[model samples]
Target: MDTITHTLFGLTLYGTVDKKEMDKNHKRAYLVTAVGASLIPDIDVISRLWDTAGQYQMWHRGITHSIFVTPLWAALLFLICAVLFKTKDKRLFFLGWLAVVIHDTSDLFNAWGTGYLEPFSNDRITFGTIPIIDLVFWTIMGIAFVLSKKNKKKSPYYFKMAWILMSLHLIIQSIQGFLIYNQYDGKYDQVALSADFVPWTYSVIVKQDDTVTIFQDNLFQEEKERYVLVSDKGADLDYLFSRRPEAKTLYEWSPFVVVVDDGKRLGLYDPRFYREGQSFLYEYIER
Candidate 1:
């Protein structure tokens, strides 16, 4: 998920807890706990500054987003609250866990996955059932916020309802994506799904031999082949890697890439992100 969605998740979590009886200090602690945990994992963004090895792609959603670090993040938040507000409420620790876990877990539903089991494995676990920025979630959160105004005394219930609705939406989307993904099973050497901005729509990338095809998929409609890229699978890339080491990293980060070795320029790109004649995640070197 994107930063805005994560921040909204924090606000929604905070709203789920009734704070009517708490003093101002306790309220501040709760707010900090909710919002801070939601954003802590993304602190890895700073790792890019010192990423001399072109490992920023792997590092951004790496160990910091691991499920193992959830408790540590929670404990840190708990200590911060204890020192800053002098509050000893242990419930804050569990709330911190929920916030951090939600942040880590939600990222798995997108094409840009997370290292959920980092240290044990480097695989980026992705379901690709949801778009990075889902308007459905924003709409649900918006409805909760709007409804809270009409019933301030029970605002927490509104946010709780929002969580339930969001979960249902995710479940339904995932099931649709799963069915779509399974349909091409064993037919292609590799396949990846990227959910479209429109619900129930997906971009399915399938590779066989040196060819990659991206399909615009809507469940009830016939699929459309959007792009067909041919890869130079036999190209020698020792020079490219030496000149642009990030190209090597990009090669490793993606499940597969369409290599271009047309003599004029030699490069590669992940077909999943191909748009407007270029891939945003592309790293290349000129001849």
Candidate 2:
């Protein structure tokens, strides 16, 4: 998910808590806990400053987002709140943990997955069931916020209901992605999904040898073939990698790529992100 969605998650979590009985200082601490924990994992983005080896791709959502490190992040936030607010409430710690956990867990649903199990595994565990920016989540949160303002007494319940609805949306999207993937079980050697910005729609990339096929899919309608890419199987990638190490990192990070060797240019890109004759995630080296 994007920064905006994560921030909203923080706000929604804060809204779910009933703070009527708490003093202003405690409420302030809770607010810090929620937003900080939600945004902490993304601290790994700073690694780009020293990423000369093109390893930024692997380092951005790396160990910091791991499940193992989630509690530590929460504990760190708790300590900050403890010192700043002079409160020792154990509930603060738990809430901080919940926020961090949710942040890491939510990222698994997108195509640019996090290293949730890093150190134990280097696999980028992506479900590709949800878009990077889910408008549905924003809409749900927005509506909940409006209702909370109108019914302050039941604000917590309304936010809780919003979380339930968000969970249901994720579940439905995942099920649809799974079913669509299974439909091409033996048709392709491997398949990867990237959910469309529009709900219930997906971009399916199926690789069979040197050919890669991309499809725009929706549960209620027929799947449309979007693009057909061919990989240059015989091209020497050594020169390409030497010139653009990011190309190698991309190759390693992606499930599969569409290799282009047009004699004048050598490039590799994930078919799932291909658009308008190019891909934003593309790495290339002019020959």
Number of the top lDDT candidate: 2
In candidate 1, which residue pairs get closer than 3 Å at backbone N, Cα or C atoms, i.e. clash?
none
Per-residue error for 6 in candidate 2, Å, reads 0.3
Among residues 3 or more apart in sequence or in different chains, the pairs in candidate 2 whose N, CA or C atoms overlap within 3 Å are none
State the RMSD for candidate 1: 1.1
Going through the candidates in the order shown, the clash numbers are 0, 0
Model 1 per-residue lDDT at 190? 97
Those runs of model 2 whose alpha carbons end farther than 4 Å from true positions after fitting are none
Once model 2 is optimally superposed onto the true structure by TM-score, how far is the C-alpha of residue 207 displaced, in angstroms?
0.7
What would the per-residue lDDT of candidate 1 be over residues 20-135, giving only the tens digit for each residue? 89999999999999999998999999998898988888898999999999999999999999999999999999999999999999999999889999989999999899999999
Per-residue lDDT of 201 in model 2: 95
Which regions of candidate 1 deviate over 4 angstroms? Answer: none
Cα lDDT for residue 214, model 1? Answer: 93
